[model samples]
Target: MKLTFPIVIAGLLAVFSSCAKIEHKKIDDPAYLRVFNNLNYTVSIENKDEEQPFLAMLIDPETDTSGMPVSAAIVGDFLDQRDGYAPPYPSHVGSSNSFKNPEYPGKESVLVGPVLNGFDLSSWAQIPSGKHRVMFMFRPVNNTPFFQLEERLKKKVLIDTVLQLDSHEVYTLHILQKNFRTKKNGMVLRQEVFHKMPLSDSMIYVNFYNMSADGFADADISLKKRIPQSGLLMFGVKDVMNVWFSLFTNDELRNPVPGYRFRYMTSLRQNNTSNVVQPYYSFPLFAANGTDGIRTTAWQRISLMVPGMNPENNPYNDQAPAEVLGNYAVISCYGNGTKPGFERDILTVPNMIVNIHSGTNNPQSFATVNTIEIVNGRAYLTTIQRKYPTPIY
Candidate 1:
């Protein structure tokens, strides 16, 4: 009887040990990718269609016997969305609140990479390193998810190309409008390398990019005319402008702050196609003190200045009166400032003061790469987060 019991227990252990493995498998030889749909057709007077900008990205589609793709994996849906901070939560106090709408939810839009306020790589999607066929097709902006959407809705391909991804490399694919007049759009793939910098608690890394369609020769004339007279002067014959990071306390503009400004940071005539990744420029993370553990937040107003504009003058100050062409404000990282009233009031206004600040708590918790992208005459900020501790098992 004892021998029989031992044999039965051994058999039960074997059965328990051999249970099928259920886990989310990790990718092999993985490469990281993030997609941003910066394509703007609103400036197009004739060809602007509301549905043309919304795109669905397909990778390695499965083909049928007829050599046409029967099914595909959707990597990105609603690619018209931009990366940035999320909007404030809507108040549920009233039945018919101003923020309540069936068509638009206040949720922030994002791709397959870092989310708004994310500090780590947990959200970035991983794909096998090799050559893969990629396609971006126009999709309707509806409740239908990309995978469930009918094939008829994805027939129109805006971008079709093969991407060669290297092992352990990171890439950002940008869909930018090539020409507003011809309604042409294209994609620019940038291999991102986070260059190591001297460690400092007070400095933040940033780079500038001019992705506006106004750079193109065939850009819409109406768009160019929309630029304020001060901004046009800064554009000058070369369409070049300098970016200034001015420290402000209360309401005073403090330029001449060392290492806070860049001369001719970007040229408006150059598009993302011709873009080479600019070197990271370090700036003081806090305006009051140049060191950490002092203040949790610091505000700075970014101004777009003409190359010839005297650096000594403070554009933000009415008394000093510098030739500051325009300035940018962070309304929402998700591009929510594009709404009708907000767009006209905040985005189009030249003298409006838009102040961007560091985190309100634990400012040194994670590092960030702030990319100031200029589209048309306005500026948008996209922050790429990095260097936060991950869970160790």
Candidate 2:
């Protein structure tokens, strides 16, 4: 019996060897840095997954849009005319700033600097009559080490190109609304950003559907920007109401109180240089299932952009002057705790349709109309404007 026990134990050990827990070693590297030039004209920074970190240096290229060179800061240091930041980094010079965001943990950091300074203006001196160039630098701070700091840092620099003035003064945007009706009688309205702007500097406008009539209220559209990538515009609407609004901006995320229940965002890509001519589309980049609070009912319809439309390859394809890309995005919430359906993928479409059912309390429906337009450093967001066709008794 003793001999048999020993054999049994040996066999068991061998069997579990592969199942043993594995631990990965931590990576160590001195604090590295990179720069993301919002060559697209908008300020945005992207990480490995292409996911945007909370750290962003929001700036409007139009603020210093000129063929002249100038000196500026990077993040921790300031520079007038140099290749890059000093020390550790070679061929770079500028000022740098660092900070963390309490809202997002461990991953909050930023480094901002000049892109094209007065020293770099030598190239633009005798060029075409209406040529302009603007540049910027970005360096991110992190808790852990990232890969390829040197290469990433250099690519982080952004450069933007613009014409002298009166570039593609297009001023037409589309507005659409989405309404949801759930079993609990829940209602929600969504706004979308449709059409593209050729100019890096422009304003956006959004109007409430029921402000003038009864049951009308207002919400402010929050403007947030991701340097170099893109920006987002969002607003919320509840119950049944009609509201009217008119707003404008030369800076996207800089707009103040554009509309009631609407928030606006812009991408750094707006300031990038590209040979392609088309407006980019705006669709929900992120959405929640609503399992925690204000659960939305199944079969509810919400505003969403229709998919398959190439926001970067469509509008201004054949136009003379370069073109700007534009698109729309919508978000909605429901209550009374209802089962979520396939709405999780609604943001992927260029146009979104969501339906909500709460069961037996209050059945509600809502919708939104959105548009995008650009003129030099000015942008506008305006909806088609709507009033309830019938009473909501």
- Highest-TM-score candidate: 1
Task: Report the error of model 1 at residue 42, Å.
Answer: 3.7
lDDT, candidate 1, equals: 0.49
How would you encode candidate 1's per-residue C-alpha lDDT over 1-393 as one tens digit per residue? Answer: 356888999999999888844454566577766666775444254444534567777788765575445567535554555533211121121224332111111121222233223333333456678999998777776656666778676567787789998886666677777664555778788876653344354466666676766444333343443433223322212245566554432332333344543333333334557636767765555534454543423334444544556555634434221232332222212112333232222232111112223344432323355666655444545454543433333
lDDT of 2: 0.23
Residue 189 shift from truth in candidate 1, angstroms? 0.8
Off by over 4 Å in 2: 1-131, 141-155, 163-393
Name the regions of candidate 1 deviating beyond 4 angstroms: 1-23, 43-45, 48-51, 64-68, 83-119, 195-201, 214-238, 249-251, 254-269, 290-292, 311-367, 386-393
Most accurate candidate by lDDT: 1
**Residue 269 error for model 1, in Å?**
6.0
lDDT per residue for candidate 2 within 62-181, as digits (tens), equals 232443223322222111111111111111211133333211101222321111211111111111122333233333445322222354442343223332312221111111111111
Q: What is the C-alpha RMSD of each candidate to the true structure, in Å?
A: 10.5, 23.2
Q: Count the backbone clashes (under 3 Å) in each candidate.
A: 2, 150
